[model samples]
Target: MIFRPIVPQELNAVLAQVRPDPSTAVSADTVRARLADGEYRHRWIWVAEPCPGRAPLAVAIWWGSPADAHPSNLDALFARSDPMWAFADLRRRTSSAPRPTTDPRSAVAAALLVAAHRVFAVDGLVPAPDYHLLLPSGWRDRPETAASVAWRRRAAEGAGLRLTAEQLRFERAADRPVPSLSNRLSFTPEPDDEIFVDLFRRCLSKSLDTTSTRKALRIGAEEHARDEIAFYRHGTRGRRSWWRIARTTAGQVVGFAIPSHNSVVPVVGYLGVLPEFRGRGFAAEILAEATRVLAAETRGGVIRAETNLSNHPVVAALELVGYRDRTRRLVFSAT
Candidate 1:
């Protein structure tokens, strides 16, 4: 088997072999766009084949750069072994760059590290110690796999990687009726000017330590404040909806949740309650209201969210609102 550069004509053939689910597969147009985008690096399309007269059996696609290269990692790992040798033969022609010496243990590790680095770099950071390989549903159970748990453990340990435990442990409490805070706080779908300003302020306060915001501006929380407001208002730009809910009696902006159908799953992109409103069940009430709205619209899909794992209160609120722990990702500092 030989790895070689892929061309536009081979897109469907490779897609057929890789068999990615419809939701995740990039369309032909998207593929062409990425190819045209000068920013993307190390994009590769490869095919694995057996001895002479044997057709190719598998296809691999990888992308990203050398300041954070990963497709190289996969090639290095696969090059070391037998049928895997054929896997290495399939490579896409990419601009030349110096390669890392460390051997990656699995294609999954290569793919994950590439993705992790991209996310971190986009936020102007590097991969963190707590980073773990996020395996999609069926990868773990495959047979004929050279990638083993022991190999993964060794590779991660060598690279100083730390992983979160697979199980999501939570303290269970007796079932009690959700407190009737909905009546105490009226749920308004639309936010007037004053309410929008208050919501923006609350989001700015909550996101002071966010990976993206912290990297870009040291003291520009106010700027980010406006950006958040604009993000909901004009940035969404006729594509998604935004709303704010405030406590009527105090007239304080208790909490805000943005439920958008922008991805494969409906996402509650932002949610927060002011510091003074903390511990008053206001966050839960806001989430419950959002969930009610989503349910009414028959939004029966996973809702994804991420926060600093150290933020126990926010994690607790998510659990209370029916979000199961999915995976923990580490955000590393970019030097």
Candidate 2:
């Protein structure tokens, strides 16, 4: 039978039954805090009804928009759990279920995830969501790791989610000197959203994330550019003072950079160089100036950045400015 959204009275009981992992069990206090603080709501929590009135065998809870949740929320809730997640609308989400080591119980969890997608759709969210797996550094070519990945891949396939792209996250401490701010490209502050989208079109490339997401959303280049700019209009977590467009001395657009932050840390929102201006090594200066602006604002905190694995040139530019690759993520979308 399908699950129902849990009510506040059942919050503790349902949370108690959710065992996401044997190693990282989420505490009731933590779940209560997140819920009471409004990180999630009754609708975002689902429970399987194996029968009419008996306790649920599995549960799925989603942390909705405001973009992110505390990273440890899931693992601690389930004690060594590796929850599958997605970006259904404006935020990242995951569902808690019994580990799929056994048959009927696993099926129940997968079904619940499918159901949650339908729930998210009511809010105009895309059917696809991202399942995040944070890998340890240097986790390549290991037989056991490969086996684990294969198992997850099969399970996701069964649920109609496809593995699309691999991403690399780069980070640096703010104390790192941003390569000297540019003298060639003038900085334009507070440009209209239309202007930013137009400039982004000049920088869009064949990115794995961009490609898969475009197909999933079935949007054209211009629409996707607008979405991209909207994701980083600056001031999501910090001030709008950090947004800038790089233009030539004559005020022609050359590139752009957005330095923003999430709930956790300062981030390089978007760094792009126009196609006609590529290979001139202009992105370094653009990014450096953005970083310099944010670093000053953040007072020497860590700065975060990410790019698709297939987008090598952008990756190279980030490295040139001293961004260290830290984590690798695989994005899965429900087909």
Candidate 3:
């Protein structure tokens, strides 16, 4: 098979070949919308074809901020040897499909990812972009869901994308009452971005965020903090003034909250409590304050946030503050 980026003229044919899967939520309309909005560029979309003149067997779509020089994440992946593969075909082959053997789709997808990563690296994008696969809540408990995810997981791992973090996605609708907050902590906007970086670095001491913690371990805390600050500053659509440092009424800095937005919707950008202030129930307070800030500004639109599934404290805080569990996101990255 030949792996390469798709041309603009081939987009319609390429999209027509893939089957829709709700788990990935990568429908043609959605792909078209993102492409139109600059989140998905032609160069970021790759495919594996039998030959130069044939139809693509698999397609990989990457997503990035409009301002980003390179794509940040793999949003959708679809592969099938048969161009007609769909729900009917999947249902017909469900019982006969061999579980132990590697799926042909997986093989093609792996080749596509490997080729795409090499090109991205040649262009100076080091450490391949992460691949995010969204699974339903309790997906592991469902046999069909588990089986479907297995092939994609194998494809990702085969392409050197190690399973890094599993996150619990949460969404709070505008109708959900804004969580109440106590007067124990006061939030004030800091004009300096450096102050937020220092606090972000301090919070890393006992952070449960798998991605950031791993980054700090690999590149040191100081640089990791600066990387994160720059990401939020330039990559996201959120305004800088939305950031606030949370402190006790006595002027003791407890934590910070960032009420931010993405290209799609508002999000609880980031929040962390100081190590010394842990176990004082400040996380919920800080998160609630961020939610309030976003709600007022967005005029009660939906706000989303995510936390590492292993981070029980943050998970509990999110639950307590009225954010409903939406889905589980499995992130794979090349280390």
Best prediction by TM-score: 3
lDDT digits (tens) for residues 1-335 of candidate 3:
56788889988998886566745778888888989988999999998766577777789999998878899999989887453343234325434222233466665676678789889999998889999989889988988778767778877887889756889999998557776757899999998989989999999997888888988998899999998888888888888888999989899999998888987799999998999999988999999989888887775468999999999999999899999898999999887
Q: What is the TM-score of each candidate against the true structure?
A: 0.52, 0.75, 0.91
RMSD in Å for candidate 2, one decimal? 7.1
Candidate 3 similarity to native, TM-score: 0.91
RMSD over all Cα atoms, model 1: 9.1
Q: Would you list the clashing residue pairs of candidate 3? A: none
Candidate number achieving the greatest lDDT relative to the actual structure: 3
In model 2, the number of clashes is: 18
Instruction: Output the better candidate (2/3) by TM-score.
Output: 3
Candidate 1 lDDT:
0.44
Segments in model 3 whose C-alpha atoms lie over 4 Å from true places: 81-101
Model 1, span 1-335: residue lDDT tens: 33343456655554444332311233444444544542123245544444343444434344332223332112111212233443243222212211222332233233333433344446654333232333333444554222433344443333334333332222211132233445767666664645655665655554523543453365365665665555555433122334646564667557677654432344455667776677777766776665555544534445455555566666777687666665433222221
Total backbone collisions for each predicted model: 10, 18, 0
Estimate every model's Cα lDDT from 0 to 1: 0.44, 0.62, 0.83
* Per-residue lDDT value at 207 in model 3: 88
Poorest 10 consecutive residues by lDDT, candidate 1: 72-81
Error of 1 at 179 (Å): 7.0
lDDT of 2 by residue, 181-274 (tens): 4478877786577877877775665333464345535676788787667656532666666789888888878888888886568888787787
